[model samples]
Target: MHKEVTIYDIAEKLSISASTVSRALNANSLVSKKTQQKIIAMATSMGYRSNTFAANLRMQRSNTIGLIVPRLNSYFMSEVISGIESVTNDAGYNLIISQSMENVDKEISNLKTMFNNRVDGLLVSVAAGSNGLTGFDIFRDRKIPVLFFDRAPHGLTVPSVTIDNENAAFLITQHLIEMGAKNIFHITGHQSVSVYKERTSGFKRALLAAGLPFNENQLIVTDLSEKAGIAAAKLIAELKGDGVFAANDSCAATCMNELKLQGFKIPQDVKFAGFNNDLISRNIDPALTTINYPGFEMGKVIAAKLLDHLSHKSDLHSSPLITMKSELVIRASSNYKP
Candidate 1:
């Protein structure tokens, strides 16, 4: 293995004191700009790597933040993480991310790992099956700032940022109602999640407002996977609803394909609408109509807010909720009338 370069080596090569080299590397204005540049150039040429642990201890701060998400494979979650990285990297912070795969046990393990690493802050989107915030007590006790985005824990004091799921779902449902969809069906994920529960509530509210009956058989709850979408399509075929609102675009696309195979016409016999406005929404034949939840923007906003709080130590007690807007995109899937 090659020998690691250090500040002492840089100082020796530059014929300067190690203290001067350290100050220059730390960007201390006490050192002249010319000297700092010369030292940095030499350090870069020598392949000198800063010891993050040592630096963190000396500064009493870790420049790394921890991020925990239910899963890492989805397009929406990936976009959100990308946006977070952009903002955190610009602010001179590193992100250590982990996925729970929607398991509560794995989510607990990830939280313990993040706490052990002593991250400056944490960002989390709790697992769907996570029943409570018991695992997050370590952060709360240690006074480490934690921010929740997207799938947040309900009734928590931690700062959270999310779009109004109820309003968005209500709007989509109203759109279907306006299209003469008397028997509308809603395909949703686990109702334990605030997002899914709120969406279901919004669907019910819309039905009541329109004087339409909310049929128990019309509501299908599943895991929001492609297979679930296929199953939902088959189930919907059996039930035969005029309009369908899926919790997400991937499921909607799958259902759309399956429904077509089962001899159902798109937006002719049955209209469809989905959420998240994901790429699949545009790629699917007879493009999916969905709600634009702005996952990427939500990430950027949450990251910026967390960084600001870390830097300023701002009082979070005043306002705990940061809500973003969601817009309904009327595409071919839901646009039945000419």
Candidate 2:
């Protein structure tokens, strides 16, 4: 195995004092830029890498921000993480991400791990049934800055970046109604989740406002997975509706595919709309109508805010609840063109 190169090696190679090499590497203003450049060049030539763990230990900071999400495979979440990486990576900070898989117990375990690691900050999008921030007291007690996005914890005053879910849902439902859908079915996840609840509420509101009957039977709650979408499609086949609104595009796309296999013509037979204008939504045989939730932009905004707070450029206590803008994207799946 190759031995690790150290500052002592660089110092010896350059015939300079170890302290001088250290100051130069640290970019101390006391050391001339010319000397610093020479030390840096020598260090690079020797394949020297700084011991960041040792440095972080001395600073009493990990220089790492922990992130927790419900799931990591989703297109929206992936885009959000990419945005976060773009900013945090450039700032020389690292992200430690984990998924709860929508389980509260797993979320608590992930939180404990992040806390034990002493992450500089935490970003989370709470899992289903994470009810009332019960597991987040430790962060509050320790004064750790926590930012929630997308499916955030309810009844908690935490800094967050997300879209106006209810308003977006209202617009989508109203659009379906405008397209002449009277009996619309809403397929979503747990109502305990704020995003799903807000979306379901908006769907009911649109129906009630239009003097259309808001059938309790039409609200189908599930995990919103692709398998769930297929199952929901099978059920919908038995009890059909004029339209359907899913909480996310993945399920909507799969549901559309399943419906097609079951001989249901989209838009003409059943208009379908979903949240998050994911690539799958656009690529489906009949592109699905959806709300453009701007996942990447939301990520960038959230990461910037968190980084600013960590760097002390912004106050954590004064962190704002940021809401990103979204618009309904009409597509062939939901639009009826004679």
TM-score of 2: 0.83
Clashes of each: 0, 0
Model 1 C-alpha lDDT per residue in residues 1-338, reported as the tens digit of each score? 99888788889999999999888877777899999889988987887764432346456577889999988878889889989999999999999999998889999999999988878889999888785487989988888888888887877766888889998999999998887788888999888888999999999999999999887988999999999999988888888788999999999999989999988888988999999999999999899999998888988988888888888757444577889988999999878763
Clashes (candidate 1): 0
Runs of candidate 2 with Cα error greater than 4 angstroms are 1-54
lDDT of 2 by residue, 121-236 (tens): 99999988996377778988878889988877787667877788888999999999888777788999989889999999888888888889876889999999999889888877
**lDDT (0 to 1) per candidate:** 0.87, 0.86
Model 2: colliding residue pairs: none
Runs of candidate 1 with Cα error greater than 4 angstroms are 1-53
TM-score of every model?
0.84, 0.83
TM-score for candidate 1, please give it. 0.84
